[model samples]
Target: MAGSAFFMACAILVLFGFCVEAELVQHTFKVSNMMVRRYCKNKTITVVNGEYPGPTITAHEGDSLAIQVINESPYNISIHWHGIFQRMTPWADGPNYITQCPITPGNSYTYKFNVVGQEGTLWWHAHVSVLRATVYGALIILPRAGVVGYPFPNPHKEETILLGEWWKADVITLQNRALASGSAFNISDAYTINGHLGDLYRCSNKHTHKLEVEQGKSYLLRIINAALNTQFFFKIAGHRLTVVAADASYTSPFSTDTIAIAPGPTIDALLHADSHPSNYYISALTYASSPAIPFDKAASPYASAPPSASPFDNTTTVAVLSYKSSPPSSSPPIMPPLPAFNDTPTAHHFYSNLTALHPNSVPLQIDQRMFVAFGLGLTPCSVNQPLCRGNAISASMNNISFSFPTTVSMLEAHFRKIRGVYTKDFPNRPLVAFDFSNPSVNNQGSFQLTDKGTKVKKLKYNETVEVVLQNTAVLAAENHPLHLHGYNFYVVAQGFGNYNKKEARKNYNLVNPQERNTIAVPVGGWAVIRFRADNPGLWIMHCHLDGHLSLGLAMVFEVGNGPTPSTTVPPPPQDYPTC
Candidate 1:
């Protein structure tokens, strides 16, 4: 007994020493912009840490993290830690206007915060509008100290596949043209895998991305779809992909030959590259839905076509999943088997159950319910208008285009606590809304273009709220991936066609609904979400589809009260830019 006790004491001492050593492992990384020649071409854009899609920063939960963002670009920039539970540290939440301001050109800001809370696959991106195109990266969080690894089986090899859209035109010029045209902007020439546009099989003098893998080896693929305004159906030739995780949450491993993902959605899949043939092409094609427009015939010029063009007609080649060079083969490359919706039990289970993998099991009734409609419309230019140079094609959430008021702070404070504050004042539901059948108007009012006001709902520190988003597929718009900052919500129900209130009420996944910070609002359909307003701060909720948000599909929510006497966030860092 005496000898055993001595051994135990030594083991405890060693464990304590290990804990002390772990503390020293915390890392501080600076995510900033540096000019890089993209596509091996002279075209330059500000990128994070000098790399497109930035660098992958990995750390375990509970580890200390210090990230300094220096804006070397000419534009103002800000980085938001997506899906991170910052607890009381709202300062590190990274809202451009709500939190500390953006980093100005030639300035730097260091964001210091501990990686508290759960461990999962998360990402970081620019908070400012449209800048995410160049400024984004992956942030993978491991388990906390003393905790076991993930519940599922771990793979031998892992790679991060960041999917993005690439445009040949200058980004600023493209944006300006789109704003002027008030129509679908630059359709990306190619989709990129990590940053390389595998110019199809026609690999010219340009460096094409080819993933070299050993034959018959299982590899984990962390896929992030960062497209601006498209959803993609991804599949690799001659291999089956087993999806095990999505949006930073673990799901039961389910096999699928092809999986569809939208912008802001991250999916983890295990690929068994063990095949007779060594090399294969991993293809990802856009799943084109109807363009965003009104349902009326007059809204679109191509509405009369017998068969309209599917959004997938144009595809961006992301990357090629290839094995090391093998013996020459006479047979053609084998394409991956297409997934049958009926055969896959997981698909049936997912739809029948209508629940998310990360269920929010909180038992709280919703105290308030809000209905929001997202669509695109046109506003006629007023005569002799200085701001309205011409007719403005715009997007709106609840029938309001975003405007920045001169008395921004006071208006922000008022909108933070009032529901329906702007509804009656800013009425003009867009043309798309009228094109949709049986358009419902809860409030009727109109606000001027000069009014820069926000719609806000006041909630206590911990209030349960439900938001129902109805997408009027008028004008044939694509789906929108809605994202909320600060809180994760339960996707209670989702489906095609219109949202039947009676059916939705019966099919609510209150028990095992997946909790997520972002969700895809299907085209011509509806999505219902429930969330607890626990985090006290001003949080922005917007479409993860960067294009839509830039056009004005976003709003802010102020939760709880401010600091006792004054609740406003501290002034931005000295180097922050007004632009």
Candidate 2:
């Protein structure tokens, strides 16, 4: 679980010395169902290697990971490295039926990928269905040996803070029922820090997640928002966080009082630890929805209110950060200020202010420009379908809903010369145009129902592509955190309302823009991101909000082969799952 020290014994010249011989990380994850109590009730939940947050896989940059995943649970499973750019090894990029088929019940799959250029906080999670509710773990990659230290000074200590949601009932059971009764959903009763739901929840006061820290010593907090559908506002009552990195990429330091974290992006913030020698409250509250749009009570009660105002708002989890030599008391700690349920400006400012520590190496010249509008839509139901009592609510990108191919994986179909699995004809521009930010705009005319198909955009190697993602106000105008599979992109510009291309182009950050694998395109707003299509594979891009992803807010990037073998995709491994 530690990075091997730099030495001169096994250095090789094969790969330009960027990759010296480093110890490979080997771990076995046994996915099984276990009974656990949350909110004072015992319920069976899926777990990885018996741990709720599983085991944190630790390795240095340039080291490869060999994770043997053994499935003992009833559900089919696939693990996705959330922020890892799979680079040349797209086969290991786990998206069920995308990169590979699921590792079926009682079966196993070994995911092997090199952490070539990534560092800082990233994570791994089950990519199949709602099973990610309990099956996920942190994948922390340290800096490469003899290459780069952290841009900021090293902290006195580092701690991993995993933010998660805890549901009493199984999500699969709920999904089946939701299929029978369209749009009925339930959110977790409580939120969790690390693995405990803190003392605020019913019967959880005995075992709260707490941290004992030395006074006046700075510590780095690697905070991950693993809550399935809720982005969070995290803060400590008496401390300030100096933001350093997001999504495993280094950022120019900026200080913020309260940090808004989306579901998929990880934050690495430096806590100066300059507070009085007393216990401080570590609080995470729900950044659930934008209050501008009317709530959809018929769909789910999750959007009814922030957790603080709901009946279970008392379930607000709180972990204590105790200063050394401070007196211990069985009392509720003070809470910090949380953003209003609909503070888009605060959320926008937090994301907009971050920049990369260094200038980007990719050229800023745009080779391809794509404008894809995404949102929830409705498709007319076939005869007497229960799931579509009226119209089946769905999600889409560019007026096309992505359908999963059950026959084979996208990578296998592309590599083995199979046809009809997917088409490389995804639209570069949206099918309809309107005042996208107008909440009162009618969706019944142009963009209400969308065509469903398996489609992708084709890109050549090394082509720099810029995509302007505009969020539509069709059903619900909510923040969609888009996660790109195989590459990290620079989020150059984002703004409220419809995007003005000329104005957006003028304001784009061409130098030292913050790089991230996931970007939260604001509700009724637009975000422009640029990435080079250098990786050869069928990469899946989708909304990280699990519900939106299930509803088909996704697309694929089919990257063409390069002239050289190194740039071309390698053959699939022997253990790759077949349908």
Candidate 3:
């Protein structure tokens, strides 16, 4: 990865033209199985370097990283740097079958790329299967060498908090069983803070994660949601959090009692330890937006009948925010009151209120306009099929469930001009246009079925694209966190009900809309984003919810090479994993 660059002091860094040359950081990850006891149950699960939420990788912006991963576990694996802009190095952008084939057991592959012009918090995770339930860690990028400080007031201390989900059964087996039986995967047994299931759960008191704070000092909390299938609401007992950045992009500072984050995005918030010295609860719980669905209680010990209508892991995970020099008291720590599990208003408020700290030039002219209706659907099952005895659950964009090619990676095929791997006929609009958000539309039989194929949309170099993501209510409408590889986009507008071009244009926040690599599309609603397609490569856009991703809510963007050698994507490296 080679390029020229300009550092930003008071400017928004665009993905195409800037690249800074800096340090070369390296790490070797050993993947293997480890036995861990949690909630009185012992289970052997895969881990990286024998650590649960593997080692954090820290580097300055504009640094190059060469991470060698040796897969010693029984399962094949690949690691994805969630929000890094892999400039001219799409082969290093890890995604099983999309960027490269998975490294098999006993095999090793080195991911080499440069982190150009990105700062603040992001993360890395397994891309092969549900293995990310345990194999993940944070990737923090600080400001470049000459930059004075953060865009906001610098905090006295920094902490990394990873929120995760846990299950007693092997996550791979659980997902395979659910797919084979045409049912939903079992709900998680419990949630974790820094990979510890705090004192709220059975047999977990001694291992609760604790953070000590001093009076009159502020701390920067780099919060990453690594949960496979749920969004979380994080709050402290009696403190306000000032959020400064998200998804490695800077945002205007704002104060909130609770922070709502879906999986695959990072939130950098400032916490002031101004309260009187005492023990405060740092808590997180599920914000399940999906409507009520049937849940099998036999699958998990923590599973119970929903006290209300919606089916969710209606449980809380807690950690202690202890004040230094405070006397130990017998009384319990003070807990914060969280929002309801289906509080869409609160989630929307937190998500939409954010604006970019430094405004960029949002493309005023659009070269490509797309309206993608995405959510869950179904496909008819074969009569003699051993798996999926009934209609198999499926998810899609524009009624097309994305199918992965087996023999070669999508990027490889695109680079080599290999035919028969995928078609460049992905629709700009859905094949069948109907009332997307109408609840009654779910009753239509044909509307619930979708076709599966490896179809991609083609884009010319440097084309500006605008996409309107509309969430559907076929099976159930929920908040789907849509993530795009290789670039960040401006979220211009979002609203409930159907998307009207004329009505939405009035509210487009083109001046300072939030810039993020991932955007949580409103539940049963719509969101619009715009970006310039300058990086020429095969990039995938998909839902961050692991279950929905496996069910096929994904699509690829095939960007053509630029006219000049400098702008074109380079060929793959020698050690690129082959199928």
Name the candidate that leads on TM-score.
3
lDDT of 3 by residue, 274-326 (tens): 99899999999998887654433443222233222335788899999999967
Q: Where is model 3 more than 4 Å wrong at Cα? A: 1-21, 293-310, 382-385
lDDT of 1: 0.62
Worst 10 residues of 2 by lDDT: 301-310
Give a tens-digit lDDT track for model 2, residues 152-265.
Answer: 988999999999888777788876665454452466778899888888777888658888888778899999988788888888998889999999999989899888898889
Clashing residue pairs found in predicted model 3? none
For model 2, state the Cα shift of residue 16 in Å: 5.9
Better of 1 and 2 by TM-score: 2
Query: Which ranges in model 2 have alpha carbons more than 4 Å from their true place?
Result: 1-20, 292-315, 382-387, 442-445
C-alpha local distance difference test of each model: 0.62, 0.82, 0.88
- In the range 54-172, model 1's lDDT, one tens digit per residue, is 87878877776767777767776778888776655566777666555567777777765566565677788887656777677888877665645666666778888877777666676
- For model 2 the TM-score comes to 0.93
